[model samples]
Target: MKEERVKKILSLLEKAYPDAKLVLHYNNPLELLIATILAAQCTDERVNKVTETLFKKCKTAQDYASAEQDVFEQEIRSTGFYKNKAKNIIACGKELVERFDGKVPDTMEDLVTLPGVGRKTASVLLGNIFGKQAVAVDTHVFRVSHRLELAKANDPDKVEQELCKIIPQEKWTRSCLVVGTHGRRTCIARKPLCNVCVVEKLCHSPDKIYSSRQE
Candidate 1:
């Protein structure tokens, strides 16, 4: 997709959802990290609901590291994949305490080394917590990018690279948040409300059910 067109789409999205932001609720970087891990195959709403109690119980790296496996699993059970998430959360806490002195690493290299922490999670921490320009290519981002032709690759890493090439560095974080929101609100996977989409005219995805331009 052309840079100019991408910019225009972004402009429209910005106007449409000026308040679009990361929906996951977190009090600190560690909470956000844990929430992101739980959010892998779950909704942010579910993660937030689970974290409401989880955070109160596990406030620090040591808390998670020392938590009972079965008990911890039950706490995050509603997030799904609780067994792995529990194991990873405990292991991630140990890594943070042992390697990083119980602090969440701001760099991608260190962050990805933690259990359950991937590029997408790292990008979220980098942009939101560390105030760095990073694009988190989650499910919503991946789908929206492909449909918008902002990226042609199937692999998320390639898509991220493609998006970085086209989207300005300053708008990287905002683009991810806006486009992800668009995917949820307008360009939904099952039933996209194309007629109400702010960027409907700019999008030419074959999957679009209705086009305002056609009207």
Candidate 2:
């Protein structure tokens, strides 16, 4: 059945990516929020590299709120979309300071209300920072879920809902971590390694094409 296949896939992925966790480097919830915002269309590796000095410069929500926009933009320019990202960070920080007592809001509803914090970012903040059950549907989760047939939904929110319906609440956060790692390592968006994939049998991709090519 599909449910059994889903469990098998999760088990394999959990084994493969036993240490999978949030890659973005941040010390506090506020920092994580800002880092996730900056991470749009950017690699976590690049974000970590930038955040090394960036965090040192701006440690608190108040620090970011009061920081000069030009300095912040220049510091994060290498991450790309510096103009918009800088603006969002400043606006988000101000909201955090004014609305949440300089602390990152723990709930998805409040977190999404902050500038540049969408459902994906809010999920990450909730799961990683607050230990709440939420599946952050980034590109990795979106692609891998479809590849594994865990979700057929076209949109991230719908995919997340489908996954929630199947996966237990306790596993939601860890499932995101595992699936994201699998996407990056094996079930990549382009040219996925179907032959070596542990969940290849469960994947809906052209299995005959892969088998024939291997033969």
Number of the predicted model whose lDDT against the real structure is largest = 1
The TM-score leader among the candidates is 1
- Tell me the spans in candidate 2 whose CA falls farther than 4 Å from its real position: 206-209, 212-215
Q: For model 1, how big is the CA root-mean-square deviation?
A: 1.2
The digit string of per-residue lDDT tens for model 2 on 111-206 reads 889989999999998999898999899999998887777888899999989999888899999999999998888877777877777776666665
- lDDT tens digits, residue span 157-199, model 1: 8898999999999989999999999998889998899888888
Residue 173 Cα positional deviation in candidate 2, in Å, after optimal superposition:
0.2
Clashes of each: 0, 0
Give lDDT for model 1: 0.92
Question: Model-by-model lDDT, in order?
Answer: 0.92, 0.88
